[model samples]
Structure formats: structure tokens, C-alpha cells
Target: MTALPHHLDADIWLLHMFSSQAAREGGVIRRKVRDVDRIVGRDAFVTEMRRRGYRVYENAGQFVIFCNREAVRRVV
Candidate 1:
């Protein structure tokens, strides 16, 4: 399982963590989160993500994803 963001609910945090690791391992993070209604209410999750140096945004379909360019640079 993936590590969760501190402010996210158990399910979303787990999903996010898993997707993140998948991406790092050269996999695509291309899943749809069914519990969208559960996430928008939690602003703290957004704040925590930004603080972690990730750039988050919604897609045209309203999916949320995050990435940290600086962190990627450091790793490379």
C-alpha cells in the first residue's frame, strides 16, 4: 500500500500514495477516483500536498493530480 498524506481520509490517502509510487516506478497514474465527493471538502489535504512541493491541479474531467518538479530534479 502507498503512504497516505497526513490530511487525507484513509481511502484517498491510500490511493494517492499508491498512485504516487506507481508513477515513480515508471507506471502511469491514470485511475479514476470514484469518491470525488469525499475529497473536495478536505482542503487540508490540498495544503499538505503543496507543502510537500507538489503542483496539484484538476483535469478537464475534474481529476486531481500532483507532481513536484524540484523533487524530480533532485532525484535525477
Candidate 2:
């Protein structure tokens, strides 16, 4: 796995949480970001998500993922 930027720690953690949840219950996962700006910016976050084969969509300060349904599901 490629090293992620230090600033994206929170974003990475957020994804881990969603992935854990998805493993138990498969479907779309939604997580609310109290302040989106406090987390990694959209470009960097999306880039990492894409690299991990996740399809990410942001709406109203929330990041949504239907990761399991994506064509590529492997994280690494």
C-alpha cells in the first residue's frame, strides 16, 4: 500500500470505520463530517478512495460509499 499523506489520517480512519461496518452489514455507508474542511479536502480524499477501489460521493458535509457494490472492491 502506498503511504498516505499525514494530513489524511482522519480521512483514512473514517474509511476504516465504514469498511468495518460494511463487512458486517453490506450496503451503502454514510458518515457525517462535523466540519468537512477540518478533514482532508475533497480532491485528496477522492483520490485515495479511487486508488482503494471505492466510489465516494459527498453531499451536505457527508461522505457516502457503496463500496461493496463497486466493480473493484479490494482495498490493497
Best by lDDT: 2
Model 1 Cα shift for residue 19 (angstroms): 6.3
Compose the digit string of candidate 2's lDDT tens values, residues 1-76. Answer: 6755674576666566655856447567766654344565566666766765666667887877665644635588
- Model 2 segments more than 4 A misplaced: 1-12, 23-26, 33-36, 69-76
Please give the distance, in angstroms, between residue 12's alpha carbon in candidate 1 and its true position after superposition.
6.7
Clashes of each: 0, 0
Residue 21 in candidate 2 has what lDDT?
A: 58
Each candidate structure's TM-score, on Cα atoms with residue i matched to residue i, is 0.42, 0.50
Under the 3 Å rule for N, CA and C atoms, how many clashes does model 1 have?
Answer: 0
- Provide the overall lDDT of each model, using Cα atoms, as 2-decimal numbers: 0.50, 0.62
Clashes of 2: 0
lDDT of 1 by residue, 10-65 (tens): 55554566567754664334324444435433365466556655554555645444
Residue runs of model 1 more than 4 Å from their true location after superposition: 1-19, 23-40, 71-76
Clashing pairs in 1: none
